[model samples]
Target chain A: MTMDLLDDLNRAIIAALQENPSRTNKDIGKKLRVSEPTVATRIRALEDAKVLRVMMQSDMRAMGRPLLALVDINVEGRPPEDVATELAALDACTSVSIPMSNPDIFCNVNAVDGEDLQRFVDDHLSKIEGIVSYEISTALEVVKLDPRFGKLRGE
Target chain B: MRLDEVDREIVALLKEDARISNRETARRLGISDTLVRKRLRRLSESGLAKITAVTDYVAMGHTTTALVRVVSAPKVAREVVEEMAKFEQISFAALTTGRFNIVLLLSARSRREVADIIHKHLRSWSGVHMVETLELVETVKHRLDVALVVRDK
Candidate 1:
């Protein structure tokens, strides 16, 4: 099997799984119109390539981490990726991104409360070397969280 | 809403593999299959947890991903977000503080496609005052498998 065909099949398999994560390998193969073994091998390949993963996400309110904030950090001396990696190691961080825009690193964190979040900023984030400035934007409400990439363009 | 140790364990296992069988989960937790099923159903019913398949947008032919920061009038921030939410391409939307009133996550086939979406839908909105786009280089880490710790009463 060529790498191009495998990539396409993997994408299709991912799309199918995104629609329904609980489907078994056999069920997924049936839906994708591929042999079961082929599906299994392709899935294993994707998994090995780190292109696919199954994850469970809990509602923040239900889990007691009601305070979700997006932090934009500006680094003066060090590389943004290094700072991002440092920030990513924090337990509160959920997502980290290095964008080609203002504030070098963008991070999303789920904190226990306002005070906890403040302390995390003052103590943890502020102490990171080369971080020139940082801004925290508290989320009033997360209107949408998870998005279906396959159905993104209404296709 | 309080979760017991068993419930947390169940969530952790599901985080590892959403498709793990009840028997396998039961064996790992040293519990009965029936109990595992009941707990899972309760968790789902209570809206505490959900297992879903998600893909990296870049992997799905979406070569470009941008985080748009919209500055809206304080009075119209909520309204602008509502309008933004109507578009299906937006993966994440949040009402926020600081310089931007709302942040939107957009993924598309190319840089041009992202610009088209912004011009066609975003700028047209009356409430939008300023719009800034942050093109993401990479998602260094996205951790969804959070471990739940039971709180004391």
Candidate 2:
């Protein structure tokens, strides 16, 4: 379902949770002028529909994986999707995607340290078949990482 | 900022369901509710963890997502990224060390909007030497519930 199908109440509930996911249903209801059960029901529906999810996300920088590497892979013989699937299986890779442009596959990985990153490139990345060549860009600083993508009201 | 065993356990429980009550978590972990509350508070305060809602851009009508690689002039990469980060359409932006100096993830309703963002804003910026848009065709995997597995050194 698209954002247009989602009612205002649903959007408001999502916004409230995005602002602070730890807030209780009762608190959200009070803040949004709705009942606690209403808030809970809306959240359940949203989750059931695969529209949104509330989960704990750890800061990789604070969790020992301070290094972020963006890799663009050029695949030759094999399908880029197959190569991306292999890369996604690795523990360090957070996201893997097939782009519609020059780079066949693009992925962002997190490593524990410089040594760990080198090991990942040498061991995992190098071993993947069909990878003709790849370029790795290390992020110096993550200026912004706001994951809330369903802000319907432009908040 | 190293997470101890107890902290890891708490995070694991919350990873399953961030909305889980402190009392429920405490009962499951066989710890006191006060301790669970304290640990969560500490984690958030220390900027080590966050309990937040992550939405599906596709389901939200943002069907197009692209990774924009920007090659900015030397000494202005950070400034360009900071400015791009302020836009609501761009979800992620950072300065990198490679051929492209800055990388950004843009999500919008359609490819037209993504192109507009690239042409109207990103290209208009003064220091932006070159811009490349890699539209994400399909997301093979996006593990939002990442495991808190800290490798022992």
Candidate 3:
């Protein structure tokens, strides 16, 4: 949290985790010339300060399902709180949010398998009272996605 | 990264295969080696991108994956996110604006495990307004599974 805490070793640890949130603290420390305990402590401190979050990175393609659905919903006059409440109830709606200003809501629904996706459309998102229309940009390709947080250090 | 046509193409290639050498990428893009090196430095300096080898969960013997949506009192969202992160397959959680307050991208060894996690863990929490989930039926391209369309000069 302090500027002085942002050392090269810490930055390296952050970078390694940014690439793979599932990596071990030992591995991160090995790369950064710090002890495992030190890495663990720093990571704890970082997490406590709300600086870093971790997640396992899974390759969805290994599953036999087809299509990475990028469902963008265009909304108007819908209270965001109300819309969020309804959208989160659907099965296929994995990630639902408003990323940009133009469109009020954006949902990342992963429909790799199951009838749940269609059911989700019928049950959750469409049922939302304020939703006007939505578009599905089925991922032609997933170009890039990486962790947004990093350790900030002055050059 | 202030990517010109050439740099975007290079990034697209790297996104697909991070192992490509500078010389190889330069030759393939018909750009000089110096230009390739210079551009790569600029991209890194700008904090615009990063490249890393991703993992496949199925290869590791895990079987089921699901995304769980959570809505709760504002005070408890962080608590929920923390609880989700402690799980092995609950890999990604984001606080977003929409119909849902918090969404988690999770994985598990079996369908039953997902059920157990939700029933035993999530279902009991207080201030939790709703719990809805969708199991991943298939995965085509993961987080970085596609190439960004690059314009050619």
Q: Report the number of the highest-TM-score candidate.
A: 2
Better model by DockQ, 1 or 3? 1
- lDDT digits (tens) for residues A1-155 of candidate 3: 34645566665776687566546778888778779999889876655544444422223432234455656576768676467656656544555554424355656676764465576577766777888887654543332223232221102
Model 1 off-target regions past 4 Å?
Answer: A1-10, A25-41, A147-155, B74-76, B86-88, B146-153
Every candidate's lDDT: 0.77, 0.81, 0.58
Best first by lDDT, ranked: 2, 1, 3
lDDT of 3: 0.58
Quote model 1's TM-score: 0.85
lDDT of 2 at A144: 72
lDDT of 3 by residue, B1-153 (tens): 245687778776765444456799899999988988888776655544444433334432354656676777788876776676566556555555456666666567788988898888877778788987766543322343321122112
- Tens-place lDDT digits, model 2, residues A1-155: 55554889898888888778878899999999999999998898887776777888776665568888898889999999899989989888988889887799899889987798889988987898999888888988787766555332221
Q: How well is each residue in B61-151 modelled by candidate 1, as lDDT tens digits?
A: 6768789999987888877777777676777788887888899988778899889989988888777889999998777776655422221
Q: Model 2: per-residue lDDT, tens digit, B71-128?
A: 9997777678878888878878888899888999988899899888889878887888
Instruction: Place model 2 in a CAPRI quality band.
Output: medium
lDDT of 1 by residue, A43-114 (tens): 766655545666566666665788888988899889899999888898888888889867799998889889
DockQ of each: 0.48, 0.52, 0.03
Give candidate 2 misplaced runs (Cα > 4 Å). A1-5, A149-155, B145-153
Every model's TM-score on chain B = 0.84, 0.88, 0.69
Cα displacement (angstroms), candidate 1, residue B100, comes to: 1.7
